[model samples]
Target: MNDSDRNPIEDTRFGEITVRQDGQNGLEVEGEGIPRVTLERDPESEVDRQIAIGTRDPDRLTMRIDGLEVGLKPAKGGLTRRSYRVDVEYRGADYRLVPDSVPGSRLTRDGVHIGDFSCDGDEIVLAEWKEGADIRPEDASIGYALASAFGTGGQPMWMLLIDAVGLATP
Candidate 1:
């Protein structure tokens, strides 16, 4: 098969934001008035992922902005295959992308609710943004990446109980 025929294009959009996955490498996020962003899995680190702002890849957890090294630290989740959330430290701020009741996730900064991430069919949507939220493109990109990599909602309580029961039996 040809390269184009091998990779199926999946494009999703809500408002000005758009996310496209080519069924191969990773997804690219684009929106109005913001730079395009791309996220790809890290082959070296099983638990780590990489993001490229525009077309640059500096490192797994670091992205250069305006000639300054912007550190992106993985506090928890998203870095692992089984994680249900992503707690990140970026630009001296703590941002959390957590699963929500909407079968999606909520984004918060320093414990303050900022926005929600949801999916419409194959399209990932930035559902809601609270008041006074700057809602940077980078943050939205990361949030979507977290949801795509890990998942939106976590496992049910019954699943956990079943795992516990299995452990007790053995």
Candidate 2:
């Protein structure tokens, strides 16, 4: 069979974000309820426009995981499978977000770097914070970034992220 006949693989899905590895080694994703999420390298710069399953167009990815159906899924891909990652900086600290699994660690809405929130094996360190005090203004922005980062993978957590940051999930 020709290379054109090959297909890509969907790597991960946490909340609303889904990761797919194009057979060509390219990575893409689909954003479910996030209306304004995009690849922005820097907050001060324009977002990096590109292709994703539903990040830009939700209806575009329907046929999608709807109807709440489940069945035998394909085995996990090789270690080298391509995927996407996002980085967020809040309160002078940076966090890397990847499509893995987290054991439900609670990150404060005020941006506290308590420890690492692990997804499968990958994780990001949150900067430590003050003990019981109203968060600074920048902390709100941090909360939003963390939520957006985590929301790129699954469902309920995505809503959690939105609520944590006061950003609308729809």
Candidate 3:
């Protein structure tokens, strides 16, 4: 059958857990299962990537990312809820600006602003310059600066400070 015509049912292992994909969007597994586990996808969201991390057997941590859900196997030490960091990369730059970094500051190829933005293990927090401001794909200067700052590995003091100060003619 063609790719689109194929409603393939496949069983795969995520770490030590087993997962069965009913089709393209439905999933089931053998376990106690998580409570109220729902997957949400926001294409308009800043981050373009999503993933679910969980463990195998008795204790499972399942997360849905990019409209798909996956299971993560616990490390050797056993099941432990670990925080994963997701960085928002826009236009070859991070939204969070790091002070005193190389390339000075720049944007990504896709015109996405790289920011110190991260997901706090539960929710994704995107970098916001102004509350109501919308990010344009064409203008990547600010995004680039932010990405560069984040790559430099420091809290986005510069961007935060700049945003706090508002616009100035210098």
Candidate 4:
């Protein structure tokens, strides 16, 4: 079989975001909730002719932008596997958003980071926020992990749990 044929595509949705996995090394993303802005410039007008065009597009006006990246490799058992890392960035905004497995961690609506769960050894753990005081293995949630990873203010209860359970590598 050809190398391209060996790879498979996958798709999943997290919250309002729809993630598409392409051929073990490609990702195409499309969503309906992105905020956007439209600006119009008149070719006939000089510097004073530039005017702000308003767009009713649902994606306009959002603080975050979505994008994708991919990496592929050969795993054991002759299986071709692709690793995908999804990320977001906050433009002109303070605070970084990341994924967490610890319970009670706060999830920010204005930050950007990867939010996903991975298997570590025999348990599932959040991929990001490896060093925080809010990660808890037992009560892990997307929100709590964000709080711990980004330091959004929360008790260290989850952190202790994550430490006790031991983090797994993805």
Candidate number of the best lDDT: 1
Candidate 4 per-residue lDDT over residues 1-170, each given as its tens digit: 01222222121222232222221221222234322211122223333111111111212211112222111111111111111111223343232232233332222323433233333211112233333333322112222222211222222445546755676533
| Tens-digit lDDT track of model 1 for 33-144 | 3355555434443342232121122244332332343444433434332344556555677777766663667788788887876653233444566768767655665565
Cα lDDT, all candidates: 0.50, 0.30, 0.27, 0.24
TM-score of 1: 0.57
For candidate 3, write residues 1-170 as lDDT tens digits: 01232232121211111233322222322222221122222323333122222211213333332324433222222111111112233334333232222222222223334323222222212233333344443222222212211222223445646765786535
TM-scores for every candidate against the unseen true structure: 0.57, 0.23, 0.18, 0.23
Residue 110, model 1: lDDT of 80
Estimate, for each residue in 54-81, the C-alpha lDDT of model 2 and write its tens digit. Answer: 1322111211122221111111222321
Compared with the true structure, model 4 gives a TM-score of 0.23
Off by over 4 Å in 4: 1-17, 35-88, 102-106, 109-170
Clashes of each: 0, 14, 22, 16
lDDT of 1 at 69: 38
Which structure is stronger by TM-score: 3 or 4? 4
Count: clashes, candidate 4: 16
Off by over 4 Å in 1: 1-14, 22-24, 44-83, 120-123, 131-134, 156-159, 162-170
